[model samples]
Target: MMRFAVLGSGSGGNAAVVECGGLRLMIDAGLSAKQLSARLQSVGIDPKSLDGILLTHEHGDHVRGLKVFLKQNPIPVYTTPATARVVRETGIDGGTWKFFEAGQAFTLGGISVETFAIQHDAVDPVGFVLGDQSRRLGFLSDAGFVTRSMTERLRGLAGLFVEANYDEGLLEADTKRPWSIKQRISSRHGHLSNTQVTELIREISHPALGRVVLGHLSSDCNTPDIILNRLRACLGELGHGHVGLHCAGQHEPSDWFDF
Candidate 1:
């Protein structure tokens, strides 16, 4: 059996946990140490019992709490060499480092995790597909666009956690960001818009895919209702209306999704 929970998700922070075969692993520790510990407890997991932490990139929103959290718990941190270098430059060196290259497959405890490159501004950003024989879970956030390799690697997932960062119309109408920032946001190496996320979901969805949790939303430019409606409609059009859809928010943890 595979069960997971998104502790929180958005530009403010991002984190999630995956449990399978008695092994518990945290995908990121972007929340404060206190929130991370409390959210883990909320999900009935002890922070100290975590087998490891897998990092997708070196961005602050994905790794802000790693140093302090690992200092208290002392778990191993896994990521690519390039990403580790960038994170180390930020003075975060509390956990033991386990480096793996992009497009590599590795085993931690009983789960098999496969990594692939993703389009993001950060150095060596990657997405993960973890599973055993029974079920697979795909995690992809901070992605600018979906790559061919990503689509191929993320197939056959029981659950998918992906980014839907912004809605094009809302982003364009927003008054806060200037033209340059808006350009950066909609760039190829920035973040995935709602339309792009919907396209990605349509390309990789399968009948066995049970749940889709959208994350990394723009607090200022995106609304849950908007993206949820778009995703629901897309799935329905594809004859996959049975798929479960949930949007993860920054301020609170989401309910555990079991497969």
Candidate 2:
């Protein structure tokens, strides 16, 4: 069986755990090792039992705590050449770095992970698709748009952590965030809005999808209801049913899922 859980999600920090059998992969290390350890503990995971860390990018809310994690834990860290170099230059400890080219498949802790490019502002930003025996999970939260290639690579996911960072209408009409900042969030290289994500879900909606965790939400621009409503409306059209929709908070980890 494969299981996964988000330690936390949002602009402040983001981390998630994916475990199969005795192998567990920490999807990101945005928080300090201490904070990450505590979050894992709350989810019944031992910090010392971590197998490795897989980074999506070098954003502060995604790779900020990598240095502390590597220095204190002595676990391996995996990322693309661009991400790994930036992390090291930014004072992240990557002495045990293993490079993974986007589109390449790698095996860690008895699970196979494949990386795919995501259209973000960072150099070579990517998301992961992890597979065990008969199960697969996709972890992607910071892409501006989804491509046909991305869709092809993401087929048959048991769980998904796609982004619904903001609601376009609320963000455009009500939010008081500066115009420049607003433009950035609405840009093609920025975060995905609820409508955009809803559209993507509709396009990529698959029956095998078990859980849909709407993560990396903006505290200022989005709410649970906004994301949930859009999700329900979109999936409902495709006749998708009973897929668990979860909203992860800044400090609160989500409930565990065993698939």
Candidate number achieving the greatest lDDT relative to the actual structure: 1
- Model 1 RMSD in Å is 0.9
TM-score of each: 0.98, 0.96
Candidate 2, residues 1-259: lDDT per residue as tens digits? 9988999889999999999857988998887778898899999988878888899988999977777777767888888998888778876644488898988998886899989988888888899999888988888879887778888877788888887898887788854788998888888888888877777677667888888888999887899998998788777877896777888888878888877
Runs of candidate 2 exceeding 4 Å displacement:
none
Question: Model 1 has how many clashing residue pairs?
Answer: 0
Cα-based lDDT for every prediction: 0.93, 0.84
Clashing pairs in 1: none
Model 2 TM-score on a 0 to 1 scale: 0.96
Candidate 2 clash pair list: 67-93
**Candidate 1 lDDT score at position 71:** 91
